[model samples]
Target: MIVFDKVTKHYGSHKALDDVSFSIRPREFVILVGPSGAGKTTLIKLLLCEEKPTFGRITIDDKDIHLLKDRYIPYYRRQIGVVFQDFKLLPNQTVAENVAFAMEVSGKPDNEITKEVMKILELVGLKDKASNFPRELSGGEIQRVAIARALVFQPKFLIADEPTGNLDPVTAWDITKLLLKINSLGTTVLLATHNREIVDNINKRVINMDKGRVVRDRRRGKYDYK
Candidate 1:
């Protein structure tokens, strides 16, 4: 469902991504694993259109991303969900409001918005915290809220960058299981993380990067840095 065709990105003279190419099929759970400065974040940013590729194409469900018009960006984004290292929850809004806000801005019907919000909250196991603000929740709970918001639209593809970075090992594993569950439900997941134990334990497909290129790609893999 997603393809990176010879994608390259450079920050001035320093290349952040160098001709990286890969394809992710529907429902595939793929992990992008690498040390810091390995261009994993660069890859995610390019997919999100937060950064344009210096060369090559990125296609999602066959549509070339860079070719899309500015007005239609949201339409494209609605097909994908993203979670970041920091749970980007609104401080003032309650959990339900945070999830509902995405639908609201997209002009969804009020009833539909309400339904989706409730459904996703339940999916992420945060239904009871709907009325609570971000500050009122624990790190894990806040992250769950972030996941719910990301899944509210039932996106075809999910991108998570360092999703378990701030949590304890046990909490990290819980979040990992959540991602696995989401993948099992047929949403493609692309995770960029440094958590070696989680990556090793999951035993999923791993794509290791170094400098700016994919150094290895393994299926049902262990953590083998060399």
Candidate 2:
């Protein structure tokens, strides 16, 4: 479980997150929706241990991640996977090489890198394109490559930030479905998006934020209170 207890974040005199609290259970698919500057990104940064909370603690599986030593932070981060709106793929590297690069940088053996890269590329439905460069794939396929890269470590938590923002509706839904499929496969998914269509259709747990606070939360929720 991931718990945020009375979390608060302040930048100078402006507060980015205000006394927010929430808990995400294991294997849960949760949508976080809010307008800009509602603290969604701030909260994610805290959860990823990229920033420290001004007051309060975040615990994962009963462990306080902020308390983890600097040397252990890398190990801790390996358990969490994050995908972003921009597909950050290397233009020069092929799909397989892009995914394999993640493991290689972490010191995995060449044999294991080859094996796991194929396994994840297959999982993201990109095995056939493994030899193709990023320029050869579509927007959705580029995003798939990014996702495959994130999955290389078999992370327990898969957090996506506006993953479908750049795609067409049809393609966006395809990516959304892909996320749903990943969640069904037992990975906890925290999707931060303001796309009303996708949010209304998913019908999963929704946490609504406004002005740095959680205004409402509902199971099988819609995009708005109305």
Candidate 3:
């Protein structure tokens, strides 16, 4: 459902991505693995339309993303969800409110918003923390809240950038298991992470990028790439 055609990205004189090309089919769980400065974040920024490619094209469902109008970008993003390394939660908003905020901003009906927020909370195993603030939750719980918010819209594609960055190995596995579950339920998962153990344990599709190029692509493989 997603394709990158010889995509290249540059910042001033430095190249961040160099002719990177790949396609991710529907319901496929793909992991982007590489060391620092490997252009993983740049790839995501291009997908989110936060940055334009210096060359080549990015297409989603056959539509060229760069050609899309700015005003329609948000609408397009509704089909995709993004979770960052840092949980970008509203410190003052309750957990329920934070998840509900996305639907509310989209102009969804009040009843629909309520139902979706509740369902997503349950999906992320955070129903009991509905009224709690971010400060009251552990790192793992906070990441779960972020995942809940990302999944609230029932997005077709979920892109998580270092989702388990700050968690313990055990908690990281919990998060990866959740991502796998989401993938099994038909959402495409693209995880960008450097956690070797988690990536190896996943045994899913791994795309290793280095110096702006995809150095390795494997299906159901271990993380032995350097």
Segments of candidate 1 deviating more than 4 angstroms:
none
TM-scores of all candidate predictions against the true structure: 0.97, 0.95, 0.97
User: For each candidate, what is the lDDT?
Assistant: 0.90, 0.91, 0.92
Report lDDT (Cα) of residue 216, candidate 2. 93
Better of 1 and 2 by lDDT: 2
lDDT of 1: 0.90
In terms of TM-score, which candidate is stronger, 2 or 3?
3
Q: Compare candidates 1 and 3 on lDDT and give the better one.
A: 3
Q: What would the per-residue lDDT of candidate 2 be over residues 1-226, giving only the tens digit for each residue? A: 9999999999998899999999999999999999989898999898888899999899999899999978887878778888888888889999999899878878999999999999999888998999999999999999999989888988889999889889999989988998999999889999999799999998899999998999998888778833
**Cα misplacement distance, residue 167 of candidate 2 (Å):** 1.3
Best by lDDT: 3
lDDT (tens digit, per residue) of candidate 3 on 1-226 = 8999999999999999999989999999999988889999999999999999999999999999999999999988877888989989999999999999888879999999988899989988999999999999999999999999989889999999999999999999889999999999989999999999998876899999999899888888567666
Give lDDT tens digits, candidate 1, residues 1-226. 8899999999999999999998998899999999889999999988888888999999988989989888888878877799999988889999999999888878999999988898899888888989999999988888888888888888889999999999999888889999999999989999989998988888899999999999898888655674
Candidate 3, position 114, lDDT: 86
Error of 1 at 37 (Å): 0.7
Error of 3 at 29 (Å): 0.1
Candidate maximizing TM-score = 3
